[model samples]
Target chain A: MIEIRNLTKRFGSLTAVDDVSFDVGRGEVLGFLGPNGAGKSTTMKMVTGFLAPDGGTIRIGGLDVASDPVEVKRWIGYLPEGAPLYGEMTVRAFLRFIAEIRGLRGAEARRRIDSAIEQVSLGTVLEMPIDTLSKGFKRRVGLAQAILHDPHILILDEPTDGLDPNQKHEVRTLIRGMSAEKVIVLSTHILEEVDAVCTRATIIANGRIVSDGTPEELLRRSRMHNALRLGLVVGDAGSAGVVETLKAVPGVALVEVDAQSGNALEVMLFPAGGVPLAGPAGEAARANGWEVTELHVERGRLDDVFRAITVGEGGASHG
Target chain B: MANVWIIYKRELSAYFGTPIAYVFLAIFVFLSGIFAFYIGNFFEREQADLQAFFQFHPWLYLFLIPALSMRLWAEERRAGTIELLFTLPVTMTEVVLGKFLAAWKFTAIALSLTFPFWITVNYLGDPDNGVILAGYLGSLLMAGAFLAIGSCISALTRNQVIAFVVSGVVCLGFVLSGFPLVLDFVGAVAPPIVVDTVRSFSFLTHFQAISKGVLDAGDVIYFVSLIVFWLFVNAVVIEWRKAG
Candidate 1:
């Protein structure tokens, strides 16, 4: 378990992390979400004992971080942002160095090294220098070292930041596989990763956490939650009637007409009082004998919610 | 102790893992030989003693030792590996001592490689072997002192070039403190006691005494304490500025 309270950090006049606090218990994978400079990496640095919090208390397991940093570090494995490594060393030598520093020796060291290598599937690049590897392999090597000691807490910063889609899936699977026993905290701007791996997601913006909850709960905060997208093979003139009829449906509070593409009209129907509108809206459309082409319920988009909560509208970001 | 040994092994191997160790060793041997044989006129002096070789070590180390120590912490910071290291379970003391020892041992290897001078002197004349051994010890101690200063300076910055240049300037000040140029300037304004104090801190004062076969306790203590003091500062600097 990792406990942080009132954690704050400042770089000169700017407050990087302002009174941030959170906890991650065993078997919980917490996905840290934020914009480019939203203190995700700073918070991870403090938790891993790499940077001291200006005003806060951090506890790992039961020990205080400030008072017992070395002991706390022994229980935590951190992969810093950019996955900085000794570029000159071969993959095997680098892993061996980390194992020894973690106090593993002889056969125990070899066993852990072997397992970590196998877990990351780095057998082929054992003799290859880290600097010579591709960005994907370098990231895997960083992951391998972090998991070599099998620490109880894993703090990874943007673990899959620059990887191909397939590599991203493999890394997510690896993180999910380890989520059953360890308290994992990884930061990324990728919204799908929150749904793919995280048990809980925290969104931070402007050095403060704007929202924190499970992926499903966060989606509910979206403006389009439980809404319906109705596609019709109708002209712009016909879309007016479609909008009027959709607004008159029982649960739909409002209907928005979107731009026409080809000969089809797109309209979004919002629910009233958190009620489900898909069943009623579909039945209403069927009774009218409308040229209905497409209709589906919106589970709420993380991208929309992320934009709404961070920097507001008209502000473009990675999400 | 175990952690120190582990870090030491890695740091030492790291030196050999790149062209750094070989290049440093080659340049160090080649430069020292050129200085002793050509400049010091070892053949012209007709002296079997390695006095000609050992005298130039303090000057040779001024540039070479800083080059070796410049990367001690500066490179770690530039590559962002310092974050990885500090996040590990090792204490700052273990890391400082380990890196210092590794550089010291590497310097020792370079110094011992000049044993052909010892062999040539022994084969040529009846030079006092004991004095030559003392010179070697003093030279090694002086090199350690220089390296410790460089290490501390390296921790203060992320730029290796700045570390190297600043360390070279600082080490030069220490090496020149006992010379007439420094003493004359100090003696003109300061009292004899102040002048003596300044000379006492000079590397030359203690090193020259030990090089002349006089293993005074004070000189040995000076070098050892200098190493310890600088290393302590190195650790403190790392702790204070690592987060920045």
Candidate 2:
């Protein structure tokens, strides 16, 4: 388990991370979502003991990151934003070096190195110098080094930034596979990735976490009102009264004509449950002698919730 | 100590894994050979000691040692690998000592390659083997002192070029402080005691004393203290940077 309390980082006048606190339970996969300069990377650096925080404390498995950094480091594996590596060393050699530093020796060290290489699928490039590998391969090599010690906590910053679709799937699968035994925290700007992998997410904006919850829960909470959009073809001029009648329905909060064309009216329906009153909306429209051209329920997605929480705007759809 | 050895082995392998070590060794041996045979007139002078060969080492190391040691920490910082190293379980002291020892050992290998000259001197003239051994020991100690200074300078910057130039200039000051021209210039302005004190702190003065077949405790202490002082400075710099 990882517990962060009142964590803050200041660089001169800019607070990179501002009093952010969160708990990551064992066997949990948490996604850190943020836009550019949102302090996700800064928080990860502080947790991994690479950057010192100006305030608060980060505890990994009950070990204080500041007071017992070595012990905390021994329990965690970190991959920084750019996947820094020694370009001169071969893939196998670099993994061996990391293993040696992690206090692995003899047959055990070799076993770990081999297992990491296999896990990251780096066997084909094992003999190549790191500088000669492609960006995706380099990322895999970095991942291999991070997990060489079988650490209990994994902190990865943008782990799939450079990977192709297939490699991304492989890495996600690997992460999900390991999530059952360790606490995995990854930060990315990809919303689909969060929906695909994260059990819960903490959305950060301007150096502070604005929202934190499970993916489904975040979407549900951020859905302030149920609304549906419908496009209708009116046989005559009677459709105008249908909008007023739909507004009089039990759960209907508001109704507005979205657009108009020749013999067609597109209307937006707002309901109190934030669940679309489309069922009642369709019946009311038919009763008023209007032909329903398009009727569908609108469910808020994770992207809508992310934009609403981070940008303070709810109308923007990521699709 | 085990951690130190772990770091040491990795560092040593890193040196050999690249072309840098081989190129440095080739240049070092080539220069030493030229100085010993051609410049020192090994066969013609028929010296009973390795004084002529050992005399040029301090000057040679002034440039060579910095080139070898300047990349110790500067490259690590520039490449962002310093983050990987610091987050490991090892302490700062072990990292410094391990890198220093690896560079020192590489210098030793280069110095030992001149054993053919030792054989040549023995075959041509009966030189004192004890003096020859002491000369090699003194040379290694001098190289360690130079490397320590370079290591500290390397820790200050991420640009290896700047680290090399700055360490080279600082080392040049130590080499020239004991010269008569520098001492004479100092004598014209300061008290004689002050001038002597400045000269006493020079590496050349102590290195010269030991290379002359005399194992003086003061000179030994000077070299040892020089290495320790600079290494301690390196540790302090790292700590300050980490805190900041």
Candidate 3:
């Protein structure tokens, strides 16, 4: 388990991470979602004991990061942003070095290194120099190094940033498999990636966490209005009255009459509470002498929720 | 200590894994040979001491030692591998000491290869082999001192080029502090006590005392303390940057 309390970092006059606090339980995959310049990487660095927090505490497995940094580091396996690696060393050599530093020795170290290589599917490039590999393969090499010691917490920054589609699938599967024993925290801006891999997400903006919850819960909390659009075939001069009558329904919020083509009119309905209005709107249209030809309910997508919670509407505050 | 040794093995192997070790060794051997044969007049006067060889080491190290130590931490920071190293279970002391030892040992390897020159001196004349051995020890100690300074300077910057330049200037100041040119210049402007204090801190002054076939306890203590002091500074710098 990891507990971060009021973690803050300041670089000169710039407050990069501002009094952010959260907890990550064991076996939970938490996605850190943010745009460019967010404090995701800085927060990871502090938790991994690479950077000291200016004004808070981070404990990994009950070891304080600042006071017991060595012990905390022993519990963390971090893959830094961009996967910084020693290009001069071969993949095997680099893994062995990391293993030695993590206190693995003899047969145990070798076994762990071999398994990590297999896990990252880097067995083929084990003997090759890391500088000679492509970007995707180099990332795999870095992943192998991070998992070589098999710590309880894994902090990966952009694990799938440079991977191809098939590679991304394999890495996602690997992460999901590892989530049974590891507290995995990964960062990405990809919405679908969070939906596919993360059980929970913390969205950060302007150096503060704006929202935190499961994917479905975030969608429910954003609570933007849902809409339905319908094309109708009605008698002449009756389409205006049909739109006005549909607007009077209990769940319907607004009704707009669209352009007419011959005898057909397009009518759009907005629901106040994001309810499924297609069926009710169709019924209301049918009762008003309008033959409903097309009706579709549009639910707010995760992208819409993200934008609403992060940017919000004009003059809207997100806290 | 075990963690220090682990880092030591990896860093030492890295030196050998590239052409750096070979190049440094070749240059050191060629320079030592030239100093022994031409400057010392090994065959003409048949000197019984290694003064000529040891005399030029401080000047030689003023350039070469910085080159060897410049990349020790600067490259790690530039390549972002310092994050990997800092996050490991090893402490800052271990990392600094391990890297210092690795660079010192590389210098030791180059010093050891000049043993063939020692053999030639022994073959040509009734040289004081004990004094020659002491000179080699003094050279190694002085190299460690230079390397410690270089390592500390290297930790201050991420650009290897800047590390090289800064470490070079710092090492040069130490090497030139005791020379007549610098001491006379300082004497003309400063008080006697100030000049004496600076002269006492010069690495070349202590190295020269040991290189003259006399192992002064004060010089030995000075070199050892110099190594420890600079390594402590290295640890502090790394810790400070980590906090930043």
Compute DockQ for each candidate against the true complex.
0.86, 0.58, 0.65
DockQ-based CAPRI category assigned to the predicted complex of candidate 2:
medium
Instruction: Using TM-score as the measure, name the better of candidate 1 and candidate 3.
Output: 1
- Per residue, candidate 3 scores C-alpha lDDT tens digits across B105-169 of 99999999988878777777788888888899999999999999999999988888999999999
Between 1 and 2, whose TM-score is larger? 1
Give the per-residue Cα lDDT of candidate 1 at B59: 91
Candidate 1 stretches greater than 4 Å from native: A235-237, A312-319
Clashing pairs in 2: A225-A274, A226-A274, A226-A275
Candidate with best lDDT? 1
lDDT of candidates 1 onward, in order: 0.91, 0.86, 0.86
lDDT of 2 by residue, B1-244 (tens): 7878877877887889899899999988888777866887756776777887888887789889999988998888888888778877777889999999988988999999888788878887888888888899999999999999999999888889999999999999988898889999999999999888989888878888888878789989999999999999998887667523
lDDT of 1 by residue, A123-156 (tens): 9999999999999999999999999999999999
Location of the lowest summed lDDT over 10 successive residues in candidate 2 chain A: A310-319
Residue A140 Cα positional deviation in candidate 2, in Å, after optimal superposition: 1.2
Model 1 C-alpha lDDT per residue in residues B1-244, reported as the tens digit of each score? 8999988988898899899898888898899899999999998999878888988888999999999999999999999999999999988999999999999999999999888889988999989999999999999999999999999999999999999999999999998899889999999999999999999999989988988888889999999999999999999999989965
C-alpha RMSD values across all candidates: 2.4, 4.0, 3.5
- For model 1, what is the C-alpha lDDT against the true structure? 0.91
